[model samples]
Target chain A: MKFNHRHVLSMEQFSAADIHAVLDTAENFLELNSREIKKVPTLRGRAVINFFFEPSTRTRTSFEIAGKRLSADMLNLSGSSSSVVKGESLVDTALTLRSMNPDIVVVRHSHAGAPHLMARHVGAHVINAGDGQHQHPTQGLLDLMTVRQRFGQIEGLKVAIVGDILHSRVARSDLIGFQKCGAEVWLCGPPTLLPPEFARFGARMTYNLEEALTGAHVIILLRVQAERMNSAFFPTAREYSQRYGLNSEKLKWARKDAVVMHPGPMNRGVEIDPSVADGAHSLILRQVENGVSVRAALMMMLLGGGDRPRGDA
Target chain B: MSAGVREPVQVMNRRDFGRALDRLAHEIVERNQGVENLALIGIRTGGAFLAERLQKQIGKIEGVKPLLGIIDITLYRDDFANGLSNPVMGPTEIDFSLAGKKVVLVDDVLFTGRTVRAAMDALMDHGRPTRVQLVVMCDRGHRELPIQPDYTGIVAQTTRSENVKVRMKELGEEDGVWIEPPRPRTLPVAVLPPPAKERSKRKK
Candidate 1:
């Protein structure tokens, strides 16, 4: 009930209390996910539509599974399959989907405010899956869940996000989301990819990866997002790996219990070493697992009973 | 329980609550024939605490402990779309398998029979038990489903307008049951009774 947002557009909309409410709800779903019979009849008659204007495997499949586990009728629409390929406008597409009467809409788009635009046109609760360098709210929430589960708290913890901050929507969401939860956020990458203006976002910007990794509780390595970048930001992949990539040696710079994380489609050897990606300290896979639960919690709150008037009253 | 109106008529004091559970425990042992493969699974929040107490009472009587579990039936409720104002979820902990076991589902109150229905559905999803029984501390009935408690502690005849409040020691309230009478006609109705026709149909 504390999380009474009509739509999950960005982490900016979530206050510290709202974030905690979501993470607490997600804890229940995490237990459900561990069950032998994971399916629940919470959203039996409701319909959820996943409209991805961009290509995705982990996020798309995660949402699909989350919806199905709740017994919701799930419809997946990809860029190649939808009439957007036939020249339909985003608003027109949203209106077209609106006619089908979905209860919730999960959207991912290449445009920055595409989810916002969809939210404007549709009555269904709109959740931003990801928008072009704008936000990936659920990803931010799942990362928060992972960190909270590991550290048992988020306040006063040092979270270092490494790699291409310029084009990564995950970075933007994590920066705002983590800071909202009272975590010290540090951004590290090459100077071109990590700008000085990022300091205005209340995060400590660093060109030297060691400075960011030192004494950090969480180290999140971001994907390069080459598709979002038109020109080269770094000279070579080898040079970037040698300098910024988190290997066994680089991992030692953090606290003894420091955990490594990645918003995946991980270029195994680029932003992070494969050993670290598959290491005991890695929460990358846990992030994916928590993704399903966090998303399910969001859908349940928005559609189930978060806004229902008290029948007893 | 919703706040505001007062004048609580005490139905069962703390001593009566203890005595009812004692009798309910005896009946359960007699019916189930010495707690062989028996499991007590309580519905969350209220029933969960009752289940734990029942487990202790049953253990004291039989000289053995029955399997215990706690279930949150929020996810399986019939009115997920509207009935509950804020659905706060709890953990459904059933560590042992329910197969071939005589499971007794416990709750604090039995109202519309909908919570029992939801609990049964949730129980099935965990695993099918050989036999399942219902137990309630209070059966203030307005039966909407074809369900009845196998072992009941207190059966109070309550009006549709009156709300039954079961305060337990676990929740920092003295163990007792109180009936809250309907609000005055000048104020808007708090808990509305079901239509007369539906009530008659339920009785049938």
Candidate 2:
């Protein structure tokens, strides 16, 4: 019943059962999330240091709030402000943080496998927030958690992940995570954005947004990589919206119960219409809210508990 | 099913269990004066079912159903460092507010009262109820915290070495109170019958 690994560095490290164990734990913690104080003394004296080598207000703040909610001693260390700004090597900065004797170090570096590299050098548990375009396990987890809460089941649901598929770590992580959860995933966007290799993870690729939207239970619109705004992904935001944007009319063809999701900081009118993003079916805010619980599940499992065996938990 | 399967010695039987809940429901209605602002919230799995049964009995008397909610105390336990390897969570549906409501909390068994402590903490976090009353099928005392149930269905005194399990038929099992003595190698549970036969069989 225990999650075998100490560090949660990759979704690749998980099986469907392991992911189920995590989602199960997160659902349990959802009660705490609903409370007024929204806190539990589960990790009272434990220290969770959020080391983000990438500038991220959203992910870092979510982890910070999750830690604080669990009554953990949380410390935030961003790359620009930390010793990394002084040219300290990744390993050096990790060892320095290790000397503080923290219980966990949640590392998010721009270089892929940076968190994995830090885990080897540090005694404390490491959770990968996001590393390069490799994997953002928690983001993927929070998204899945939101969908599961709304749909009651992830199995057999048609999840359409649209926009900038090639550059999205969220898409890659979701592809692996959702497929493992038994959902049929459809990768939708321009041909350049929707790479053929994504099919290796069991997602069907489609260039037609309308085809992906039809019969889909969940529509996940990725933030069009701002860098892609200049590249060959699409000609312009106007052209892209007319084709791939999840506008109100495009949403009409989706299942009545179908939901719109974005790993936010949305390009509102670009990838999604403001109407649909704020629409009753959108689970964007809930996805953000679930981040806390999913992160709490990860920290609790990694630090003191590794998925309770059979009973008592 | 085995032919002529004999019934094991139990603290309470199906009919007695049903009668106890009916009595508890009457006690709740009488004590609360009426179901005016009253609500029933069950701790998940065990308490939730008992709450439903209690609601049914109360409904028969009052002709009106009290608002019902659920609390899953899995994440709220104080003994996270001990046992709790694979903590399974259940649904907590409280569509109504606990604010200004007289809430009756229900559970199957009252052991160390740690679960009650967790449940109270979990419930308070949701919203402050004008009043909070506790109910349990069996009050098996071990008082780790200064907590007690208000409307007790049965007070079954158990030893520190025995487990009091309230198996319900709602889960397709039987309804009875079966006490379990400490196993040769008991898991971290304070008191639970020798791990079910198949579970302990695997250990062998």
Evaluated with DockQ, which candidate comes out highest? 1
Alpha carbon lDDT at A275, candidate 1:
91
Query: Native-contact fraction for each model?
Result: 0.54, 0.40
After superposing candidate 1, which stretches have Cα over 4 Å from the reference?
A227-230, A306-313, B1-6, B183-204
Tell me the deviation in Å of residue B106 in model 1: 0.3
What DockQ does candidate 2 have relative to the true complex?
0.29
Model 2 CA deviation exceeding 4 Å by range: A1-5, A24-35, A149-152, A188-196, A206-217, A231-258, A273-282, A303-313, B1-8, B62-67, B186-204
DockQ of each: 0.40, 0.29
TM-score of each: 0.92, 0.82
Candidate 1 C-alpha lDDT tens digits along B65-106: 899999998889889887365678877788877888999999
Relative to the true structure, candidate 2 reaches a TM of 0.82
Task: Report the CA-based lDDT of candidate 1 relative to the real structure.
Answer: 0.89
Tens-place lDDT digits, model 2, residues B33-81: 8799999999998899899988888999999888888887766777765
For model 2, what is the alpha-carbon lDDT of residue B60? Answer: 93
